[model samples]
Target: MANENCEILFDYLRSILYDSTPTQIDVHSLDEDFQKLGMGLQFLDHAINELKQCSTALAKGNLSEFNPSRDNFLCDNLKNIHANLEHLTWQAKQVAKGDYSQHVSYMGDFSNSFNQMTEQLKEREEHLKSEAELEKKHAETVNKYNQLLLELIRQSNDDVLITNIDQSTILYSSHNKVRVEQENEILYYFYKNINNPCEWNMKDKDNRYYHIVTINMEWQDKPSFAHFIHDITQEKKEWDRLHQQAHIDALTQVGNRYYFQDEMQQFLNCKTTATLCYCDLDHLKYVNDNYGHDKGDTYICDFVEILKSNIREDDIIARLGGDEFCILFINGSIDSINQKMEFINEEFSKQVVDYPQSFSYGTIYINGNEDTSLLNILQIADQRMYALKRKRKMTT
Candidate 1:
């Protein structure tokens, strides 16, 4: 009986070593000495079964399946791993909720990787926040600038127009509704030189002048042009007044000597055909000495009217001094101009009742090929007039 009990005990121990679940021994059938061994093996089997259940649950990722008892120290390490894994899962949930503050420890390489991932996520989150803030600031800046631009456009004296390259459609106009005719005129001028955006001047139907500036620009992300039209009618009038004061004779309303010189120089530069007539009123000194300066002025004005009536619109007449005048005819024959002058002189003599209001004129034809200076031409004309005056004195 003792040998049979020992053999059964040895076989059970061998089965346990082979990782097989040994059959539980009946401790009551064994003798006193063997019974103790039998009970010890039974306890060993229970512990091994507990460990297998815990290990299987862990293998299947079922952490709740096994709870290690205080006496079951064999699964204490697995219990720690399960606790760590549960905490890590909670940390992962927190991270998913945008919390990168959670950290792990004692998890070897996984801990390092988790910490690195959180750190990188935090950096990325901060970067995104910074970009969002920059975008917000940029948006605010753009809005402010847009408001300022709108206010400036509203306050501007110039009529601001934004349009597509097409002439008829106006995308935006700073001013209120414009008259149809005026709008058409503006668009006509605007599109006339759309291909060449530049500053120019145009006159409206009402004879109002405008200084226009066109610039290529974008409106609502579409290619467009901005037209700034400034009403320069009043300015133009003032400029004309100033020009008249500067370049016109106050008495005769003709061009002054300065104006004549400037026009002659410009005409010379053109190198084109023209005729110059230098004239002197026949008895200006005698009229001033006998009938006072007023009649002399009247005499000068009367001769000026004759010259003006005979000349074309583009022809220039300049009062050089008291009674000497210069008349320029662009592209005319010297003989024809001289005849025109002689007729004017004869007409003036016939009209004069109070005094001799006639004039003597010397004309020179310019073919534009000559490189003669204006002073030289005037000197020759002056000498010819004096010679003609001397001959008239001898004949009369």
Candidate 2:
């Protein structure tokens, strides 16, 4: 009978090992030795079943479903996996909440992938933070400059006007109350006088001069135009007075040395074809010594008139000093200028028959390609003029 019970116990233990439902054992009916073995088999089967249940829950990602007892030694390895998974779950939650310090060490390949993911996330977040800081600083700088521009616009004497071209209305005006009623007139003036962005001059009905500056701009999210106007009547008058004093000679009412230099520089910069002639009146000192100083003045004026009549309106004639003159013939050929110079000499001799007044002249053809300064050009022309005067003296 003990042998038969022993066979039953072995069969039942084998069934438990293979995870099959084992036949029940009656410990009371067996002998003492057999009963002790049957009881131990029952405990082994129970622990194995507990391990299976816990491990199954873990495989299904259900960590909270099972808690094995301390005596369940078969489930020790499973419990370790469970504890690590639970800690890893908490770490994942921390990572989601922007904490990047969490690490997993013992989960094999899964640990490596998870750590790499966290490191990339941390780097991305730090880069985004830096960009956000830079954007904030840029916004602050733009706003500060905008405020300064507004202050300058407010404090300026210029009449700041912003007009909505599409709406045909004034959007903003520095002199709002004063110029509000003149909206139609202002728009008319802008449409008629202003075609591009430029500084221009206009006169009001009262003959008051105003300097107008216009630019294309945007206002209130719409295409617009900004017109800055200031009364420049006094400014223009002052400038003209100063210009006349600086550039015009008092004696002959023509361009002085300063004006001649400026004009020569402009012509050279433009690189245009032109001709320069330097001339000096003959017997001017003799005329001043014999005839009165008034006659000598009359002689200079008559020569100026004759030169002015012979040249085109665009040509420049300037009295360099007493009895000396320089002329810029715009787009003049050497042949045409030489013929004109001969004619001028003949006319002067006929006009001043009493004192035999004539002139000596030297000419240079400028193709506008000379890499020379105004002073150098003037020196060359002066030497040529002296050479001609010496030749004339020898013949006389």
Candidate 3:
């Protein structure tokens, strides 16, 4: 019976060590020694079960239930594994928070990989920071240039306006000299023709003229317009003064020969009803030779004053040359033009005492014929005037 108990105790111990099957032990029927052996085997089985639970907790990353006894080899190994896992968890959290300096030392190949990852992360972070700084500097430079351009526009005399396509929103304006009525019209026109650039004239509230240039452009990613206005009122006045000097006779303050020809061509083009009267001073050369050139000048002025008094405000008289003159009597009949010429001759005779200030004149009435050129009309009048002058000389 002792042998049987001993064999059962030995089988139970072997099964605990090497097999997964449960062992049956008859401890109540055994002697003292066998009973003590059975109690030890039961304790070892319980310890093995506890060890399995600890191993399962570790596999699942749960360390709460893992308590290692002192000086125990297997438990000590588990404790070390748990400690390493906790430290690694802390390092991973630091790395997640942008601390790329976190490193591992004890995990051999894993430590090398972790350190390499941190180094690459730090390099990428630095590159991104550098890019951010460069972008900031570029933005500041663009802002500075914009400010300078704005200052230049403000200081310049040229009026500038920047607006959206509708012009309901004004983006920028250099000055506020544009009239409200004209401004509205300009915006309406620009909005309708946003693609075309143009130049034109406008008048402000003070009746001053402005030369305006408009261009199509983009502002803030939207279709827009730019208007540049230059005040040209003074320029226009100066141009008018120059034009008058060019077209007017200096001494007589009447139309010069150039003005006479220009008006003749315009009248012919429009088929106007008019009479061309060519006249020559009867004794201008005699007066110039006998009483000096200044007296001849006075004789000419006296003739012009008599001509102006008889003619209407619309009639144009011009000095053709030194001793010749021409008249364009607008809408005048042949009889009315003859009467005017006779009256002028009679009045000038009384004004000049030294030399007879009579003028011989020839008239050609325009009949609105398309074939009649300005040259032909002037030539006919000039020939008749010379014929009259020759007749007068023969009689004297």
Q: Is candidate 1 or candidate 3 better by TM-score?
A: 1
* Candidate that scores best on lDDT: 1
Off by over 4 Å in 1: 1-135, 165-168, 176-181, 394-396
Q: 285, model 1: CA deviation in Å? A: 1.3
What are the models' TM-scores?
0.63, 0.53, 0.56
Name the TM-score of candidate 2.
0.53
By lDDT, highest first, what's the ranking? 1, 2, 3
lDDT of 2 by residue, 73-108 (tens): 899999899999999999999999999999999899
Candidate with more favorable, higher lDDT: 1 or 3: 1
Question: Model-by-model lDDT, in order?
Answer: 0.84, 0.83, 0.80
User: Which pairs clash inside model 2?
Assistant: none
After TM-score superposition, the amount by which residue 114's alpha carbon in candidate 3 deviates from its true location, in angstroms, is 36
Cα lDDT tens digits for candidate 1, 1-396:
889999989887777656656666678888888989988887777777788888888788787786766687777888888788778888999998899999988799999999999999999999999999998998889889978987887777767777786555888887743455776788886666444578888888899988878898877768888877788999999999998899999999999988998999999999998999999988899999999999989999988898888889999999998989999988578888888888888888899368877787788887789798998899989988988899999998
